[model samples]
Target: MAALQTPKFVYMNGGLTAWEDARLHIGCESVTRGLSIFEGIKGYWQPDGSFALLMLRLHFARLKRSAMLLHIPFEHDFDEFSAAIFELMTALVEPSRDMWIRTTLYVVEGHWGENTRSDLVLTAYHQDKALPEPVSLGISTWRQPGDDSLPARIKASANYQNSRMARIEAREQGLDDMVMLNQAGRVAEASTAALMMVRDGVISTPPASESTLESLTADFCEQLAIDRGYRFERRPIDRTELLIADELAIGGTLNEITPVKAIGRRELATDTGMLATLRSDYFASVRGGKPHPFAELTTLPKVSA
Candidate 1:
């Protein structure tokens, strides 16, 4: 894949401004201490010369909750933020290409344990690509901590260190990614996605209590399964289940319903039966290729200047 160039303009601090000129102090806690909250959002180009963000409301709600959990002292009207994002897409991103949009809030002042000022940056760039092929996964020895250790549901920048460690280990093991277990030794989520396993026609995933992040993509897949009259549930998944399951799939803003071809040397089926239908429906919904039930969730309201 070619490198994606950042657009000349981005929404920063409350306005559509020049990207190169945006700055944050090096000594700020958000920069020095990694105290930042963010969201990963995707938009698909439609045939009507427009792009629609997937689950814009849900993403914005999660971003706000993450900021509050981290004590970043952040506040923003959702409508305003949504409008800003829409405006950025209109100005910087082309309507014919898929795009990834990110909104991050950071603390710009004070030391640890002190209240600080906050700043925001929203960016959009082209990300036209297909979902990845089935990947091989390795079970990481590193354990995902419980919510008491850190806010499990929030998408905080510091929390990704756990995933980063597992990712590095997976690379060393010659695998595509790693799945970390919870403190209870049960399967948690993959690095940045939620995991779902199929066994005897039943699809189940570990609950959020198992330290899985609240994943919008996972929710979408679960809804798709229900709407399609498939059996799906959220429950605890044992570590051994991964090796024995008939099929496994993962979902997130980046992965978007990718299947697992093998787990450490145990090869599994892919693009067959339920997993195949889920994958097909997922891409169709995100890319405007089918009648998507969640299309309204992606539509941004018209913003007047």
Candidate 2:
């Protein structure tokens, strides 16, 4: 029989508990109301065999911000959360080829109109041994919800249903992933990332106002474009712009710089595509927590700013 692969430890309310032991009854506020904030963090193995929890400080900051936006107050001490995360990572007797951690904060056991008190769940686990390589995506029938119509900016659990179903529909039709435009018919983003295009040396992205999730990865894309001596514009993007752009990429926690090889019948340029370049740049610095924070937006150095 193949060896068991499930992760064993998870940080629950206050301490580390066995993964199978971490459970909540059905009525938890986070479950019932979908009222939870989370960040997906990746850690890179350093040259010395130690791993740098790349962007540790940044992910926690975003988590805090999402919590605040959801009216679930948190007294976040970034330094402490950093220590906890690393401590949990260190406890692993057998770290995988790489690690991905879903660090989350939510209200415990309650429902509509219930007082929200926070609980934390931090789980670190192994993913498929293969590192992320560029993959294709499709145009999801789903449209991005407007900011007021939905809590579009927060990394709340409630929002993933849209992307989840989008991905499902795409695969059911035999595509990789899906891109979703906003209600305005403006190209908003992919199911879980920010989408951008490259054409005639200019980089273009849908404006955040179109209801794309405010993303750290998107900020990284902008910084990378400036460093690479490319131009950038964020405006309402026409759906056709994506189809005809010279290159296309999507940036997010797990799908950073995923390419759109073909959207329906339109094939993107394979030469020096935006996704290919971003694929190299995004992980190069962020993998081991290198570069200045301004230069490498995904990783740490969230010091005092």
TM of each candidate vs. truth: 0.92, 0.88
Model 1 Cα displacement at 235 (Å)?
0.8
- RMSD of every prediction: 2.6, 4.3
Give RMSD (Å) of candidate 2 vs. truth: 4.3
Q: What is the lDDT of residue 34 in candidate 2?
A: 77
Candidate 2 residue 94 C-alpha distance from true site, Å: 4.5
Worst 10 residues of 1 by lDDT: 296-305
TM-score of 2: 0.88
Model 1 alpha-carbon drift over 4 Å, by segment: 1-4, 295-305
lDDT by residue (tens digit), candidate 2, 1-305: 24756687888777788878988767778777777889988765544445666566667878888887888867658766866676666665244466678888878855564566787778887654364555577888898788886767788888888989998998898877788988888788888888888877788887779888777777778888788777888878888777777888777777656666777777765436655776677667755435546532322222111
Error of 1 at 21 (Å): 3.0
Q: What lDDT score is found at residue 86 in candidate 2?
A: 65
lDDT of candidate 1 over 112-200, digit per residue (tens): 75867887888877765656789999999888888998656989888888899999999999998999899999998998889989999
Give the lDDT of residue 207 in candidate 1.
79
The Cα error of candidate 1 at residue 53, in Å, is 0.4
lDDT of 1: 0.82
The most accurate candidate by TM-score is 1
